[model samples]
Target chain A: MSAHAHSEDDHGSEGHDFAHPMSVQTLLAVFFALTFLTVITVAQASFDFGAFEVATVMFIATIKAVLVMAFFMHMIADKPFNAIIFIGSFVFVGLFVIFTLGDSMMTSGSFEPVVEELAPAVAEPMEVKVDGAP
Target chain B: MSTIEASPEVGHDDHGHDHDHDHPAFLAHHFDTPEQQFDSGKLGIWLFLVTEVLFFSGMFCAYAIFRALRPEVFEGCSQFLNTKLGAINTGVLLFSSLTMAWAVRCSQLEQHKGLVGTLAATLSCAMIFLGVKSIEYSHKWGMGLLPAGLFAYDPSNPHPTDHPNYLMYICIPFAIALAGVLLWLVVSAGLGNKMHVAMAMPLTVVCLCFFVGVGLGMVLESGDETAEHIDVHADPNGLASAPVMLEAEKAAAAEAAPAIAASGAMVSVDESVLEILAGDASNTGVTSGLNALEQQNAAAGTSTITGDEAVVGAITTTEIDVMTPTTAGVFFSIYYCMTGIHAIHILAGIGVLVWLLVRAVRLDFNRQYFGPVDYVGLYWHLVDLIWIYLFPLLYLIR
Candidate 1:
């Protein structure tokens, strides 16, 4: 399919239509959606959702990011290859965060006691002994 | 692959000409068609954007790790961020993205005037973002809400009395640039050079937007401060109660006043000194130490009080809150790292947008060659995308 597209590009005339100019309405709609989502996120911060707070905030942000990537960035009209690789990068990011966070959470119980035991010693001021002063 | 091999042969046939009349000047010699060239550039920018995403993900990972490890710290430090300013900046950036997307559309449609106007508006918004950011940073710096090893935020007195006015220092360079552009505008108008005049006019407005940002920031920040003050005054257990403590300390200090006068020491007691004394009166050891120092100064015939001592004395006497370097400071470290790098990207976007501005002024872009505009637009929107996440993460923590 890409080869067929390339062959057309080889024989295509000058000023061939590839530009996909977004309508002003779409742009304004995206902007308003983003603004509205921003307000929702800010408003949500005032309420406590316990363990779901970060997840909820991130979900709203992801929606805003997708809107930006799709319309403002023209990803909706963009080549499939570009969109695939760009979206694919997030998979790796998810992997990286999940693995490290899981490890940290698993070991956190052991780490807490060590920190508590060492904290008092760390907090105390050190006594300096001067040579030959006594 | 076959088309790629055929393009160079075609280019080789017309290699000696001063201009390739067959192809537009914006079309590169390596690419056979503008569509192909635009496709290649588009792919290249998307890949670059991919790398940018990965690079930023590392910081996001750090944020997730730290917040998971210490959610309470993020909760404590997030209050220091002004949500109103964050919302305003979010709106500014969203509007800039709108202008940027519109600029791309204008370039594609060959609307040169609209193109230039949108680009200039985008640039002005970028400057305003930086301007507001400088206010946020300087305000934090003045309060000593810095990263680890530099955090000195005192919750009792969030605003330190002696911190330098960081906003003035931040604005000095923009002020000079504004002056330079205004002078250029005047000179160009005087010389009747329409092009230079046209250039300088937009440049001057862009520079003025920085100061406008600063003024906007100052107005909002002062309003927040005033609201806080009113809240404190209304609360019976808040800092408003300090004055009652002040009166008691004054009575105690009055008892010690006659002893110093009998010693022939001409000590001048000022309000700030009295406030410091009052603030430290709960600590009897520090109060006695201060009194002894005053008596020693009297015996030495040196009655002058240094401002540094007063500030230091005030800090030591105040109780340190949980928002110190070891606790909430790490959140600020991550905050500065993420947002600081994002601001640098905005600065970079401004540079490239200026380049696009000059090109647009030359009427360089059309339907076939708006790749640069589109590419820069993508980059600009990415910066906005990062801020979308940053605002909620840094400022909107529950």
Candidate 2:
């Protein structure tokens, strides 16, 4: 689909538009909420969460992404198809990570490179003995 | 306004209006109605945004896999990043998204003044974001905290002024100057009492000039860094690229006078981006800071400085410790890739918005024909959405 859409009136004033725009107040509210969430995420990162760090940050990020897709991007008031596409795209992203990352973890050890020559030579310092020259 | 609804206005000309003209100048021939056109356009933008999501997802996957494989390295490298700057950038992008949305709403409402105002505001925010990013990049460059092969980070080693990132310094001034020009033009156009075409049109043209100028300038400035970018999977010699050597030259020339640190130039990669680097890791690189720390800590009180003091106070060994990062090269590689792509998108969005601003000043958009503004708004929001995720993942990974 093309990025630009052709309408009856470019600005669509010809017919009273059926679509509804969020009120300025609502838009501002969403803006503030996003900022608040950003603060929360940054603050949370400083504290050690051990294994939960990834999960917690990911969860917060998901919430922020949702708010953006919904209110700021108008997915909430937009066509269902558009919302589905956006959500489906993420689902696919999740799948991509799962297969690649999951498989790599499953068989991580003992997968050494066949060519020993390929390994970059680890530099070792010379041992200087200060006794009478050998 | 808070409880407003999308109910079609009574005056909508869905039925053939009295005007004999079949289509408005803005309407495309194929679209049956305005509603269809609007929905189709929105859907297309959503789809485009979806593609963008998938684009960044690949990078995210790479980062995740590497982090999973080398969790300790990732953690140690994460410390080298300045979280404060990341937070600032997050706020900048979010604010810009808000302004972009406001511009779309203004176009829809036929508020020409607000449309121009919001567009100008969004452009400024983007410039600010880029400026801050450039500063961060320069800081990294100066400290020699680079991606692999070129990774010379030694935070514990004292040598703050070792390698100044000339590229970043050059780009920052260019960005600031152009941003200032754009601001002055927008304000002049807006503040004029009369909407005189002669007066306002030039402002739009000038806005485009600086926007294009800054964009081009940024691309050229980063050209050096981009040229050095290698596919690390190839892992060739772990050779530091030419740009690293060039920067190192300037650094060496600057610091060569301090003969006190000559004894410290014992390691191969110790000097900031330039002087002591002779290509081979063993030729001139500083010994590992971990080793120095052990030796100094072991021999404390014998000299004027201790291990920690020597690391921070002066460059006595070939190994300079700046941003004591371990395995930071891969982490930074991912960091630059993700943020760099996002920054490119912002540049593209800026280009679109600049065009919209020109038309907006032309009074082309009424309530009926603001599709371009709306579409661009969606794109900008998606850019912000990605950053929302990036901030915590890259900066706050703990």
Name the top TM-score candidate. 1
Q: Which stretches of candidate 2 lie over 4 Å from their true place?
A: A1-14, A109-134, B1-21, B155-326
> Compared with the true structure, what per-residue lDDT tens digits does model 1 show for residues B1-398?
12132445454344434133336678775765678788888889988988999999888887877777656557646766877788889999999999999999999999999999999999999999888889788877876777765666554454454666677788898899899989999999999998777778888888999878877776675555433322222334544544555566555664656453345543443333434333322233224434544555544567543212122222122112224445555677788899999999998998899889878887889888999999999999999999999999998864
Candidate 1 clashes: the total is 0
For residue B84, what is the lDDT in candidate 2?
65
Model number with the top DockQ: 1
DockQ computed for model 2 against the true two-chain complex using alpha carbons? 0.24
lDDT of 2 by residue, B170-199 (tens): 465455655665666577667773444433
lDDT of 1: 0.72
How high is each candidate's TM-score? 0.76, 0.66
